[model samples]
Target: MRLLVIMSLFALSLVAARPDASKYPSRYDTVDLDMIVNNKKVLESYLKCVLDEGKCTPEGKELKAHIKEALETYCAKCTEPQKEGTRFVIGHLVKNEKEWWRKLSDKYDPERKYVTKYEAELKSIS
Candidate 1:
């Protein structure tokens, strides 16, 4: 019984620590871009996961569309502070991904497909 209770607590803690992807509101019309920008990891992971999934699966395509639209909307309404915070997070992603793409571009697309695809959008906030 004690062991069961401890394990339950551990499970709950793990779940609590995980980022909330659902925080990106379901209705795009209702999305609070600032919230997503503040919790940038969720948005970053959504973007990178879609890329990591290689643009083939239906789920990947859906996520790509959602994140792309969300980003577009965010860019339109973002204030300087929001853009600053978001740029900081996205810049980190760009740095890491750029290095990966450079190292593997010949084996990948040689055109730096992922970096090229996201770099402009990500840097637009800067």
Candidate 2:
């Protein structure tokens, strides 16, 4: 009976030590854009545009569109491996922006002029 209890306790402990398979993957795999972009001129241009937009703009839609275009253009000009690398960077940027917007709610809006400036910067990078 003592051995049986010990075995049962050990089984329970093992179960407790194991993580839930359902939560196997979490947000930890989420990428970081700053790390991916590093000191790349194109990424610098994109970030500059995003910052110049002032984070208070109705022009975010237009600026986002332009940024996507610039990313595509940059990818087009890159070699195959470079294109893959840039894609990874851009993916992280997109993911980060989405997460930021979701977390900030409506607090981060910018003016049209700011957004236009951002769009222009993206265009310049392209």
Candidate 3:
């Protein structure tokens, strides 16, 4: 009887250990290097046009806001520094997508293939 009770408790604990699937985005499973790269490219293009122009017109402001929103939506799991790195990339891309996006952005971008790559590395240390 004691063995049975212990077994039951172990099973219960295992059940509780499972992650809550509904809380995470469905895209979590599909995320890959290509998706991140594509998103980054698009984000860079959008921001470069807006910030460098400095007009701050309604349309430019709206584009900046949309880029920020998109970053938050897609990279929600990223850390503060990773997010900041992403912003830096966006800013550089806005300034010079072809020339300095890779150079001026941050070391993190070149070091990793995907945005999550940086996150994974950071999490490993912690």
Candidate 4:
């Protein structure tokens, strides 16, 4: 009984230790953020999808599925590359695409909790 209890605790610890990171597939990590961000039409489509104003491609759907949790957890599950990509994209939006960023923040970060955490670095980028 004691061994079973110990084993259960260990299993639970492993599950709890790794959260959102495991849930998101690394396949998208190779996606070309530069291509998307540099192309206005492409960016707009993704924005529209995320904002629920348009259709979602498979990748967009995958992003939308995890966006909420990613924000809430401050991307706790994100790998290093994922975190870097987020910073780059968000910096671009916050600096170059204020209106869209505002809409996104309003939708996913209405309280500004996540924004507040990275405000300094994001602002300093440019």
Question: What are the runs in model 4 whose C-alpha is more than 4 Å off?
Answer: 1-23, 124-126
TM-score of each: 0.29, 0.26, 0.25, 0.78
Encode model 1's per-residue lDDT on 43-81: one tens digit a residue: 433334444533323322333333333343443333233
Candidates, ranked, lDDT? 4, 1, 3, 2
Cα lDDT, all candidates? 0.31, 0.27, 0.29, 0.55
lDDT for 34 (candidate 4): 67
At residue 28, what lDDT does model 3 achieve? 17
lDDT by residue for model 4 (26-121), tens: 556655666777888977777777778889666666566666666666666555556666666766676677787777777777998766655576
Judge candidate 1 against the unseen true structure and give its global Cα lDDT, from 0 to 1: 0.31
Candidate 2 residue runs with Cα over 4 Å from true position:
1-46, 49-74, 99-126
Which pairs clash inside model 4?
Answer: 21-77
| Candidate 3, superposed: residue stretches over 4 Å from native | 1-49, 75-96, 100-126
TM-score of 2: 0.26
Pairing residues by index, what is the TM-score of model 4?
0.78
- Alpha-carbon lDDT of model 2: 0.27
Clashes of each: 0, 6, 1, 1
Candidate 3: pairs in clash: 48-94
Give me the candidate number with maximum TM-score: 4
Candidate 3, number of clashes: 1
